[model samples]
Target: MDGTKALYYGAVALVILIGISVVLSVISAIIGLATAVISGIVTLAVLVGIGYVAYKAGSWLLGDDDSASLDSIGTGSSSTSVDAGSSRQDRLRKQYVEGQISEAEFERRIGDELETEEIDDIDRELERER
Candidate 1:
């Protein structure tokens, strides 16, 4: 079964087991020690069974692949790296379009293509202008 169904059934079983334990505890108090021991064993077994099912379901939801570990999945090994420089270029282009910089200033800053030097020059000029 799916993880959700497994978890739902497991939780329901746990609740039923707890209710039975409580009822048995009350009965044992009225009767004797044997009922209490039996209830305790049943409760322990049910809890262990639930725990094992939950663990298996969790493992199934998370892929079985070794690379599915959180650290490994998020590491640079999986997919494309974001171009940090592109964000800066995008910001500069937006500012230029928003009339934050003069045409000459924008052209001079964004000249030819997006290079580190151009971004640095724009930053320096913007700082000086401010």
Candidate 2:
């Protein structure tokens, strides 16, 4: 009777071990499949991005005779020069209005900007044009 009981227990343990191994194998396979699918999607996105850049480059190089497009290709800055001091002053004014900066700090920054040479040159140029 003891021998039969031992055999039954051993068989149950073996069955449990086999079940656990099967479950683990299935989980590992699912993870592998998911990783492969995600990798494929990421690779496809990168290829599409590269293809778009190449297409744009080829179009720019081989497709146009238009002067307007060529003029815009590498020249991105505004034709008219802007006064950095005035822009900074405007930003400071906005910040003061928004209560982001103190009045004294805003006033000091505006004073500093007024003393800059670029602003002086811009003012002179404007006066000359006028």
lDDT tens string, model 2, 34-81? Answer: 999999999999999999899878878896545556446532222223
lDDT of each: 0.71, 0.78
- Write down the TM-score of every candidate: 0.27, 0.47
- Show pairs that collide, candidate 2: none
Candidate 1 overall lDDT versus native: 0.71
- Candidate 1 residue-wise lDDT at 83: 43
Scored by Cα lDDT, where does model 2 land? Answer: 0.78
In model 2, where is the ten-residue run with the lowest total lDDT? Answer: 74-83
Most lDDT-accurate candidate: 2
Q: After superposition, how far is residue 76 of candidate 2 from its true place, in Å?
A: 18
The regions of model 1 sitting more than 4 angstroms off are 1-31, 65-130
After superposition, the stretches of candidate 2 with alpha carbons farther than 4 Å from their true spots are 63-130
Instruction: Give RMSD (Å) of candidate 1 vs. truth.
Output: 22.5
